[model samples]
Target chain A: MRSTVMYGAGDVRVENLPDPKLEQPTDALVRVVRACVCGSDLHPYHSMPAAEQGTQMGHEFIGVVEEVGSEVSLISRGDFVIAPFAYFDNTCEFCREGLTTSCEHGGFFSTAQSEAVRVPLADGTLVKAPVGDDSALLPSLLTLSDVLITGHHAAVMGQVGPGTSVTVIGDGAVGLLAVLAAKRLGAEQIVLMGRHQARTNLGREFGATDVVAERGEEGIAKVLELTGGKGTRAVLECVGYMNAYEMAIGTVRSGGIISRVGVPQYEEAPIGMGSLFGRNVRLAGGPGAQRSYIEELLPDVLEGRIEPGKVFDRTVALDATPEGYTAMDERTALKVLVRP
Target chain B: MRSTVMYGAGDVRVENLPDPKLEQPTDALVRVVRACVCGSDLHPYHSMPAAEQGTQMGHEFIGVVEEVGSEVSLISRGDFVIAPFAYFDNTCEFCREGLTTSCEHGGFFSTAQSEAVRVPLADGTLVKAPVGDDSALLPSLLTLSDVLITGHHAAVMGQVGPGTSVTVIGDGAVGLLAVLAAKRLGAEQIVLMGRHQARTNLGREFGATDVVAERGEEGIAKVLELTGGKGTRAVLECVGYMNAYEMAIGTVRSGGIISRVGVPQYEEAPIGMGSLFGRNVRLAGGPGAQRSYIEELLPDVLEGRIEPGKVFDRTVALDATPEGYTAMDERTALKVLVRP
Candidate 1:
């Protein structure tokens, strides 16, 4: 098997490795059909501590069931499936409550960039995709494993619903999709904050009614100006950068919500009376429980009601997966898809 | 007119001040019938800097509407009214959205400790309480001016609803009232964390089903153990201490909510992936929009469905207002009622 590994910051390589085998009766062997480089991957590309043994990379992928462990009941060999970024037994109390990432028996994915990988808790972690392995919708289906569902999570946490307005920070794939999710959930106004022309243009197509290219105070001012000085009712923070967090804080109206789906890189955020409390703002969002969300979002993707795959601006072959990391890290690609 | 003032840390004095008169066309002159020393008032009592001219004190009161400015339409002179801790014109955008504390023209009250005070934005800030200023329900009606409504805000913002379980931190007047609010909202299990026997006893009467006297890790361990190691669906932080915030972080289950109505004395709280984000926990709550909540909660207080006045365990005359502050600052009383 050829898998992705990170040796240090900016050092990504794809090399041959021993094939994975089912280590648990609840595991299933997945031969990946599609994988992608995530913006979070860029975090390590910029500053991952050196690891001599190298860390296995990738957590999002769409694959076909190559083999199923004896106890795996819901998944079968040759079935097309998408595994959420984390593996969780869907029946656990946390999972049942839609907090699947906190599943007692769950852990995250690290080998999904490989040609084939072992998925644990197969029946609970892998949701059967209603398509053939070579379907054209694979790119969109692939996003369900992470990004798209995370965008949905941000919208949901922000309580985006009919007749509300929203401010989306960051033009990353997740941010753009958050605009889509908010629009789908019936938000009347979607203001996307980003400096990227191409991405903001796409954001416009996806449902952004306004775009603020300014940064920092200017950005906050622009959003506030657009919102009649009240900011938006919901601010979706899709970039974990401190400035983005600050912008979210500045652009959230009193009693509004700031939902963060991007993994926060900073530890301390001002939550005092001067920041959130004075405005009566709520803070929500986290790593998406995609195992719970994948099913809910699949029908829309399958019916082509949403075109989330448009986020993948570049694609590469498995051996050239290293380029996918570099392209995203250098901002040369919005998102990079990899085919084995 | 006698009024309370804070000259320095731990220094409180009651002295003569000129009676207030309407300063705005939207203002109302009110004669204070009842006011109370609040937990928050103690914050300044413990850390106020010495000044040649002491700061005016008190923000919670039920008063007789002695006079109304020409523009005051909703409230009439001689009507009993309750003023929230903050004054706001409720027709403002923020107020219309139920965020009265963040109203564009809003400001805090500082002269409620005086014999008479001028309340601005009378039509929006003062709600008629359906009783005379001398009614026996004065204490409970006064609680609606701040504490009880704030407790309701904590519960409401934490999303306390039918059959939900909650862990309320602190056993202050607000904390005990939060237990009552949670029970009123149909919370099936109410776990209160506090060591004060008297306060916790009142909490029990107010619907606290379980009480944990432990603090810190042991407290977290106790709460987790009680919730089968999952914590409760909500943790109401009624104490603004950092440790109370920490307990909130520790006891909130995955995807649960930690609502803080207590004004956080600290500026930064851990909201990184390791704290709130990893658990997918949402943070909600603020000073509370009591002007908006007062009307809704008034019926319960007026109908005897709740006895929020039970929190006021001591009383002081106009000249003895200083004693009220002293009693609350020393924790000799859960809350102190001041008559002027």
Candidate 2:
């Protein structure tokens, strides 16, 4: 088996690795069908001093179950499944409450951009795809494992629904997908905030009613102007930076919600009493409970109701996964899909 | 007319002041029936710079309408009314969304510990009590103007409802009332965190299922222990201090909400990504939308179902208002009710 490994900053390699096998009674062996590079992956790709041991990479993948341990009852061998970014024993109290990401027995995936991987808590972590071996739907299904469902989490947490006017900040794959999620939730107006013409064009296609090309203060002003001086009813903060969070705060109307799904990078962000308190703004959303949303969103992808896979602007063989990283890092590609 | 005035740090004086009159077409002049010194008032009471002109003190009051401008249609002379701590023109978009504290035309009350007050937006800001001249209910109705309603806002914002478990940080008047509010909302378990035995006693009386007297890390650990190590589903952060906020963050379960009605004093509270993002905890609530809750809560107060006024541990004449401040500041009283 071949797997992606990060030796250090700017050093990604696809090397032959020992094949994974089920170790626990609840574990299952999955042959990877599709995988992708995440925006957060860039953090370690740019500078990860802790990766001195050549760490296994990738947490997003969809595959076919090749083997299952004795305790795996919900899913069987040869079943097409989506491995949500986090593995969780869906029977836990947290999982029962729809917070699978916080399940009592939960852990993140690693070395998923490989030929085969061992999935723990298989019964709870794997959501069988409705269709069987549909190569064209692979990208979209893979997205449900992380980004698309993450966008859905933002929309749900922000309470974006029928007649809501939403402003989505960031032009990354997650932001674009949030636009689609908000649209699916029946938002009346969806504004995508992105400066790049190419990304904004894709945003328009994803149901953004308007696109503001400004950044920071000007971007907030543009969003406020677009919403007639009062900011949007819901703001999806898809970027985790301080400025992006500030813009989300500034672009949401009094009493509106700011749903942040991006993996936040700041240790201390200014939460001025005068800002959040006076306006009664709500802050919700974090690491998406992707497993909670995968089942709900899987049908949409299988039925072709939404094509979130369009975010994958490039696709490469598993052996060439390193180029995929460079392509995204150099801004030549929006996202890279990996086929193992 | 006479009013309580803050001349400087530790200097509170009751002095003769000019009578207030309706200054705007939408204004109404009310003769105060009851007023109370709030916990927050101590912030300026203990360290106000020399105020040469002597600023008028007090923001919590219930009164009888003595005069009304031509435009004041909802309230008239002889009607008893509760003026929310923050006056708002109920016609604004924010007000329509039940966030009157953020109304486009809204302002905080000042100099309310007086014989008369000129209330702006009278028709929208004043809620006429169901009964007239009921001095026994005066204290509870007065609380509707601020503290009690603020606590109610905390419960409402935290989404405390039937069968929910809640942890309330702070044993101040607002925190005590939050316990009552949580009970009214049918919360199954209410934990009140405070070190003062006297205050915690009142908290238990107000429906606290448990009391954790520890502060900081110990307090959070106690709460986690009480909730079986998973933390509570709802947290009411009634203290504005940074440590209280941190404890609230640490004591909320995954996907739980932290409703903060305390006028947060910190400009930059540490909202580390490691804390909020991974657990998916939500932060909501602000300067209690008091006006929004007054109408809905008035019936309960009028029907003698809830006695939030019990929080007032002492009462003082208008001339002895300074003693009221002293009583509260020295911890001799939970709250002080002032009769002008």
Candidate 3:
């Protein structure tokens, strides 16, 4: 089985890894249909995370169930499913409360991002999709495994509503998808802040009414100006950078919401407590509890109401997974979808 | 008119000042029946604010409407009323949205310690009592002008609910009333962290199930331990100190609500963004819209379902306003009510 492994900074390689066998009654073996590079992946790519040699890469994917243990009743062999980024026993009190990402038994699917990944708590963590010959859309659906769900979480947590003025910081795939999510949630004004014309165009297509190429204070000013000086009613902080955090605070109106989906790359987010308090801003968004929003959003995607898969600017074979990682790392691709 | 004035740090005096006349059509004259010292007053008392000699100071009071301008129709002369700490024109967009404290035309009453005060937006800023001659309860009702309302705001903003566990930080009148507020809101478990035996007793009377004498990390740990290591579902931060802010965070469960009413004495609140995000805490609360809660809560108090005014542990004559401020500042008083 081939899997993506990181040997050092800026070094991702496809290597033959041993196939995974069910070690627990709750586990299911997933033959990778599609997977993608994530923004968090860039952390190690840029030498930001601890340098661990030969670590498993990637945490987002859609796959076909190749085998399932007796305890996995809902899903079976040949079922196509989107695996939530976090493995969780959905029956837990926290999971029942729609915080599946914080499930008490939650763990990440972290064996060398292989062809056959073993998913724990399979019955609760895998959401089977309607079987189809739709190979092309698999990459996009695989995105549901992370970015799309994350984007939707950002919007839902922020309480984005009809006529809400939404400001999205970070033009990465997740940020672009957040624009789509806000649009799906009925936001009237959508502003995307990023320099790349292609990604910003995707954001525009997804319902971004305005785009600011500037960064930091200038970007905040642009958002405020676009909002007629009142600032945005909701801000989606998609880049976990200090600048994005400050912009999220600066651009949100008093009593507004800031939903942050970006994985924190810094030790602290540069949020001013005084400003957050005085403005009465509500900061929300955590590791996306995909189960919370997936059911609600999946039907819309399946019906073509939203095209979240458009975030995939490039797709490659599983053998070229390393190249896919490099494309996204070098900023040549918004998102790279890899098919096994 | 006699008013309270701050001559310098630790120098609050009762002195004769020029009476206020109608400056706007929305203004009215109120002969203050009762006024009180507030936690915010301590800021100026400690000379933390821009020092101005002989600055007028008070923002909380209950009184009789002695005169009303032609435009003020809701309130009539001789009506006993609770004047909001911040006067707001109820007709404005912000006020219409129920955010009266952030009203565009709002002004905080600051005649310092005053026998008579001019209240702007009388029609919108004052909540009249249903009955007269409740003078014995006026001291408690006076607290409605600020502290009680702030406590209610904390409960409302924190979304305290039936069966929810709540923690309150700060033992000021507001904090004690927050215990009452949480109880009224149906929180089954209430923890109060504070000093002063009187305030703690008042909190217990108000339905506090636990009291933590320790401050900072120890207090937070005590609260978490009391809640079986998961922390409270709702936290009311009544003290505007950095330590109080941190304790509020430390004592709440993931996805808990933190309603903070403390006006930060320092320019910034020391909150780590990572902790806030990781814990999924929703932070809210500030200057409360007293008018909003007074009407809803008056019936409860009238019915003896709650007696927030019981928090007034001492009373003083208008001539002794100086003593009231000194007592509260020196920690000799939990709360003092001033009578004219």
Candidate 4:
């Protein structure tokens, strides 16, 4: 079997590795049908230290159940499934609260970029996709494993609903999806704050009613101006950069909310009196915990009501995985769909 | 008229000053019946630089409407009114959205400690009290301007409601009132975290279901211990110190909320991926914006259903305002009420 590995910063490789087999009673063997490079994967690709033993790559994937252990009941061999970015036991207290990322017996997946991988807690971690593995909706269905649901998480956390006015920061795949999510949730005003014309164009198609091609203070002023000197009720921060967070604080209207799905790249932020407190703004959002969100958003992708997979502007075969990482890193590809 | 002034850190004095007069058509003159020192006031008293012309102090007060300008419509002379800490026209966009603190024409009141104050935006800043100026309910009604409603703000922002579990940090006036407010909102489990026995005892009276007299790590551990190893769903942070905010992040459950009504004294905080993001926790709250909350909470105070005034353990004449600040600064008093 061939799998993706990261040896150090800027080094992504596809190498032959021993095929995986179900080890636990609840485990299942999945043959990867589709996977992709995530924005977060670029984090380590930029600064990770060199090591003799590189780390396995990828967490988002849609696969077919090739084999299942004795305890796997809900899932069976030959079933098409979508695995959430994180593996969790659905019965855990946190999972019951729709917070699967914090499930008591849960952890993230790291072997999704391979031809075949062992999925733990199969009954809970894998959701049966409504469509077959070869369906045209496969790309969109794969996104429900993370980004699509994550975008929804931002909207849910920010309490974006009917009549909500929202400002989405960052033009990344997640940000663009958030625009779509906010629109699906009935947001009346969707302003995309991004300087990237190519990405912002997709954001516009994703239902962004307005686009602000400015950054920093100017971007905040434009967002405020766009909303009649009062920023949107919700600011979805999909970029983890401190400058984007600062803009989130600056543009959130009094008593509004800032929902961040971006994994923070910085340790500290100005979240005290002068920023969040004085204006009564709220700071919301976190790791997507798509395990609970997949079922809810899967229907949209299956029925072709939405096409979140538009984010994957390029695709790569197993042997070309290295080039895929480089293309994404250099911004030549929005997101790269991987085939094994 | 006598007024309280702070020349610098730890320096407070009450001196005779010219009586106030209306300068705007929306202004009204009010005789101060009662004023109180707040926990937030201690912030400036701890580090403000000295000035030749000392800053006039105080923002919370209840008084008789001595006179009204020709434009004042809702309020008239001889009416007992409760003035919110901030003054606003109440007709602005933000005000209509229930964000009175961000009113376009709003500003905080600083002459509340004086014998008389010229209140701007009288029709919007003042809410007529159901009880007379001399009634015992005055103490509780006075709290509606800040503490009591501020406490309610914490609960409301945290989404505390029937069957909700919450933890109230700090046992100061606002913290104690928060326990009362959470109780009023029907929180199922209320944990009051504070080391001060006197204040914690008052918290118990206000319906705190559990008391954790621990600080820092021990406090966070104790709270987790009480909530079955997962922190409470809502952490109402009433303490402005950074340490308290840290505990807020530590004690919030996965996907829980940290509602901070404290005027955060610090500038930076660890609110990125490692803290709020990883757990899917939401940070909500800000300046109490009681202008919108006062009316909703007034009936509880007027009907003797709750006694938020028990937080005011000490009283002083206007001439002894300086001593009041000392007593509060040294933790000798929970809160001090002043009479003119």
Best by lDDT: 1
What are the clashing pairs of model 1? none
TM-score of 1: 0.98
Q: Candidate 3 on A1-340: residue-level lDDT in tens?
A: 8988887777788888788899999999988877878888888888834456588887888888999998999999999898878899999877888888768888776542568799999999999888563665676677688898898888988899898889999899889989999998899999999999988988999999999999888888888888878788789999987678888888988778888888765654433446676656777776885586778877777877788999888888888988887888789988888777
- Candidate 1 reaches a DockQ of 0.86
Clash number by candidate, in order? 0, 0, 5, 0
Return the top candidate by DockQ.
Answer: 4
* Model 2 alpha-carbon miss at residue B78, Å: 0.6
- The residue pairs that clash in candidate 2, if any, are none
Please write out the lDDT profile of model 4 over residues A1-340, one tens digit for every residue: 9999999998888898888987999999999999989999999999999998989999989999999999999999999999989999899888887788888999999978889889999999999976677899888988887888888898888889999999999888899999999999999999999888899899999899999998999999999999998898999999899999999987888889999998899979998778888888889888886665888888888788999999999999977988888998899988889988
The better-scoring model by lDDT among 2 and 4 is 4
In order, the B-chain TM-scores come to 0.98, 0.97, 0.95, 0.98
For candidate 1, the per-residue lDDT at A317 reads 96
lDDT rank, highest first?
Answer: 1, 4, 2, 3
iRMSD for every model: 0.8, 1.3, 3.2, 0.9
lDDT of each: 0.91, 0.89, 0.82, 0.90
Better of 1 and 3 by lDDT: 1
Poorly placed runs, candidate 2 (over 4 Å):
A50-52, B132-134
Tens digits of per-residue lDDT for model 1 on B1-340?
8889889888889887888888889999999999988899889988988888899899988888989999999999899888899999888787887888888899989878889989999999988877876689988898998899999999999999999989999999999999999999999999999999999999999999999999999999999989998899999999998999999999998899999998899979999999999889999998885666888888999999999999999998978888888788778888999987
